[model samples]
Target: MASPRFLLLFTTLSLTVSSAISGSVVEDLANLQPPSDFNTTIMKNCQHNPSLRYCNSSSMDLKEIFKFTIVASHLCNESKNPNCVHSFDHIDLRNRPKMAPLYLSYSFFWKYCPLTVLSIDLSNISLKGSFPKEVICCDQIQALDLSLNGLTGEFPIESFAPLTNLTFLNLSYNYFSESKISDSQFFKRFNDSSFIHSGILPSDRNYTIKAILLLVGFPISVILMAVCFGWLCFQRPDYLPRMFQRKHKFTPSMLRAATNGFSRKNQMVRSEGVEIYKGTLRDSTQVRIEIYRGCISREKRKEFVEECKVLVELCHKNLVQVLGWCRTRNQRAIVTEWTDGETIEMWLSGSAPPWKQRLKILIGVVDGMRYLQENWPEVVYDLRINSVLLADNHEPILSRFQVGDQYSNNKKIHKFGIFLLEIITNRRSQEFERGEAGLIEHVRDNYPENLHKVIDARMKLPENMFDQAKHGIELGLMCTDQSISKHPSLNQISHMINKVYESCLELAPQNHKRSHGDGVVGKDSSNGESRL
Candidate 1:
């Protein structure tokens, strides 16, 4: 007849009372048995029969987080000096620092440092910002759990390579920016849930099986592939797309001739070991030949071809078109249509245009990026100003479409938000050797109150558009979150941009009416309405 809570409480009290009563009866028997017995002995044991209770020579290690909290050292034998591990192979400070009245703040608990064969648990201890560097110090640690904390930063495999004996690891619920355990074989032993919400995915492809299949079926596949290729050329060419046709594959010799022996005058370094050379093909079509300083392995040659096909096939008005590709054993290059337009970065470097012009260009970039999100399989990483080009016609051309939810957060959207700030403020992040700290950090520290300071003096956002710009700045701040899951969707971003832009459209007509002297166009100060 009792409620569930009352019944549960009643059962717990009854069990406790029964156990206490049983323990006292055994204690009574042990008192009549051995007078030299240990205190609180549960079993009826003679002092000589130490097997039934705790003993120094026992092989079993009693593990209780509260009780076993320190590391101890002692002589191995009477003949040997100290510096020997007499402690258990566990260093669990799991939620202990705050509850250290019993054991004086860990003692560091690593006295003789017998941490080699260790099982550590430091979860739920409010570890924020980054994981403690001291973890890698125990090179042979077998078990570690750092879950339910704010530990972040690069938790890559190589960083944990010293922990060769690490059979168990848990790093869930952290904000790590560069943990690449996903799609890796080395981390396959750990549970996938341990990395859930942290964005570390499990290895889907078994390379061992893949290698075996490649070895056994490669020769047969090659012949079958040729037949399929021929069949596609004769019939269903859609199966083997025109982008994959041999005509787009330019030889190294042709590319070298086009680039005038990789002339420095025509060359621009995109990144380390990568050069973009402006060249004219035999057909007189100008091209941007970007070559990497490496050789393509035979295994990756087919992948390279597939990559080239994808690059050339993605045709969008805003996207820079990849015309063809150049490949050889010692050389590899992608040939995209050459553009006379400058990057958004270059425009800002000199003198950025009015707010209207910059906003229009960003809108084009948004549309291009949206299309890429729908079609491109790759995750877009580097969506910077230098990558977003403006053509001769002043229309935005997203030259670097390398390849998000929400209106939720990821790097591409975050960078796009950063791009918005860049355009609005006429200021680039410290990334361009032009600011203190990150642009996002600067904005977060002082925004809305210091909105005037952040706005570009040169931009002169129309008095009517000022409110819209502020709204956009707020949207950009949200989108730049480190957790991409927090970012708003492309549709949401597009709407905000359009909303601001629509205000521009509305003001344009009013401005034209005023310019035409439409009967003394002015605001009625008392009524706060337009007067004409």
Candidate 2:
């Protein structure tokens, strides 16, 4: 509204004043300095920490200095952030040349930026290394927003411990393994989300510990398994499969020592390729060692061992017990429990025993055959008078355990008839001339008329047993019949003998835990001959 001359003069004055003000703002910003109480530690430590070493140079830029001033003023009492609790507004603090008044206002904050920056919102800035060391150095921080930094390592509890005034801390989305801060340092205002992934749980640290344990424990487990396998193979071959199940487990060297190296003096009997020797064990138990001299191949040795397995299982009072077995490169040997007294064949060579004693021997022989045929009918044995060994009490024991499947029960029973005749008649079957009938045929042809004449002249039978003797002679003839079907089964023979001899034979304990019977016919009741 004034005249043109007046308006032009006012505009010139205004331009001069504005230029002076703009010059003052530029001068003030250029010469800005932090106050005495400022946290210079943030810059000093950040300069030394590797991650924030660039902070020192970045802080020197005027534009960044302007941004830093805004950050400082955001927490001041004079100008607090409008939305500090949830999110922060983006601030464009680039160095543009227009606003001199805005520069003067920020210059005032640049004066106190170090002291007044109690709050920092550097969230989502991709800061690293267990959070920026710059923030930890600014220990006066109260509300820190370092979320989404992807920081890792041991949690900085010691560094955070000094930040006693910290209240609104957001360290979410950071991985940390340890937290040993004192309870006093964990103030009540801290929300659960403040440390959402921050403390007291496993991170990558457990993987390292597991790797070390595996390296040490794996070798120890393998060593233990090897030791157990070795023990099982050596000490317990029976528990293994049938192919690996060994027999002749006694070493030949041990048996040699027990037999005085097979001295001729120790030899008890010898025939064909077999020999029996008297041996004494280390435990002072007597053993009769029988050896096969020519059998040497693995097949032959296998046959010998297979025979031993059967012998070991056929335990009974009347059967001679196989104590152990052994084999060498060219020999197989079996050890048996040593029984005293000679075979029944040798006994008859001397003066004939009383008829009662001979009858007892006959009954025991029947019991032994009964057990053998009933349990192992397919088994083979030499059922001859010569095979009957006498115990100390003259109880008859069959000498041969089964070795193969060659002899049949019917054939063995027919031979048993010949054995009974030898015992009663006291005559050797081989002594009869070949042109004449043998003892079996002789006894079969003659009847009760020849029974007393064929009976041993030295034997004197009791009057009550005369009829029993007659029946026994008739039974022997029946056993020798030519037809195999005519032979009595061992069970029938046992029952017939038990019926005829029940009044005379008493029971006595036999082999332990064997099922042949509860006991054997060990005692003769007729005359105090309790150990027949």
Candidate 3:
């Protein structure tokens, strides 16, 4: 409405004001001050390095500085000196534009203060190459943000074990769709948001159906599925297979009563914001209730529900059963059948079991895995001793922990091999001879003849059982082979194990034949002995 001259003046003023505001923001970021409690001693050491141009401690925490703006003066090149890393407790450069090469960042990180960076944010940096193992060198890292990059090759997820303090992680929108992570708990703190654009994370049911239709040429089944899914979404939302379901609606009062007012004394395992409580139902039935704390995001809640739905649908004696799920005012809860028996790891820590017992447990785990691989869309991404719960009868039940297809079946086979070696050597995968990287390599290096040295000293094997142990070791070695093509299928392994068991039974004394369950033909039940 103003005159042309006045309008022109106003437009010019607006542009000038915007430029000034932007410059102010940049200057403020450049002159950011470090916190009072920041380790100045370390800062002095870093300041000694001349190559680092933008090394400054900051009071700004992770949430405050979600993203960083790079100015023309900003310089973060590779440094040879180890003291040239950023002195700040948190460094967030997410969605950076034309940023410095990742290798430069890595070199800087590796050279100076690699372990000092507590939090990192480098998403959308157009990062190329496989995720470097150097990132794992940040032993004190709590929150890592490496989403939306051009990262390629298999992600060495096992390397993350050293970063025990990691709390928040984001690896979405990257080339991690096909990459495998062996630990299920590693993904528990994160959600589908972290795994977006990756098949390893759960997807929307509607989108998944559409994807299937697209692949199968839009068949009639697609239409049928769409109609059914629509109906289920509106009428029976709980029946849908996808995440976000309410299995049982128990009141907060009922839960509190079951868990003795959620007492700390009833706590089983506490990690992150999740608390597991041992409870007893009104009918005196024992149960383990997992309560997700208030800090859990909606995405994490959905993932928990989705995982529970999968567990509920799976019916296997060797797999733990999911009883129900509940949501209250502040927390989400999942109820699972409680087993009083010790974990396989705990059992192994005490005394080495006989070959027959160990083999039986191994077969149970393999059977559960076979069932899931055949019936479910997921695989056991994290299979280990802690996940194997030994029942009162010494039956091994696989815990409910699944990951997407990013990890191949070959990886699971490799883990099975490791499990075999653990049983044979009576040593953990983490514990190995000096200079050895992994138990697999150690076993392969001294096999067939020198295996006796690594074999459990507690084992007083009968003559016939030695052959069974040797066969197991051979199978283990085959599964652990570096090449995926060389590994045997679960079916083949199952058949071989059956053959071994039958041969061992045939060698038992004829008088030992009895109506023993679990394929064990023996007369003795008391004191766990074979009576002839």
Model 2: colliding residue pairs: none
Q: Give the TM-score of candidate 1.
A: 0.49
Q: Tens digits of per-residue lDDT for model 1 on 306-424?
A: 77777778878888888877666776788889999888889877865876777788788888878877877462424677778889888888775332122223666777888888887
46, model 3: CA deviation in Å? 99
Model 2 alpha-carbon drift over 4 Å, by segment: 1-248, 435-437, 503-532
Task: Output the worst ten-in-a-row residue range by lDDT, candidate 1.
Answer: 70-79
lDDT tens digits, residue span 189-285, model 2: 6755566555433332453445456678789889987786666456544345757645536666567777888899889889999999998866687
In terms of lDDT, the best-performing candidate is: 3
lDDT by residue for model 3 (179-233), tens: 4444556677665456655444444344445555666866777889989877766
Worst 10 residues of 2 by lDDT: 1-10
RMSD of each: 30.5, 20.4, 33.9
Which runs in model 3 stand beyond 4 Å of their true positions?
1-252, 294-296, 328-330, 379-381, 433-437, 510-532
| lDDT ranking, high to low | 3, 1, 2
Model 1 stretches astray by more than 4 angstroms? 1-245, 379-381, 401-409, 431-437, 483-485, 512-532
Q: What is the lDDT, from 0 to 100, of the residue 57 in candidate 1?
A: 24
**CA lDDT of each candidate?**
0.61, 0.61, 0.63
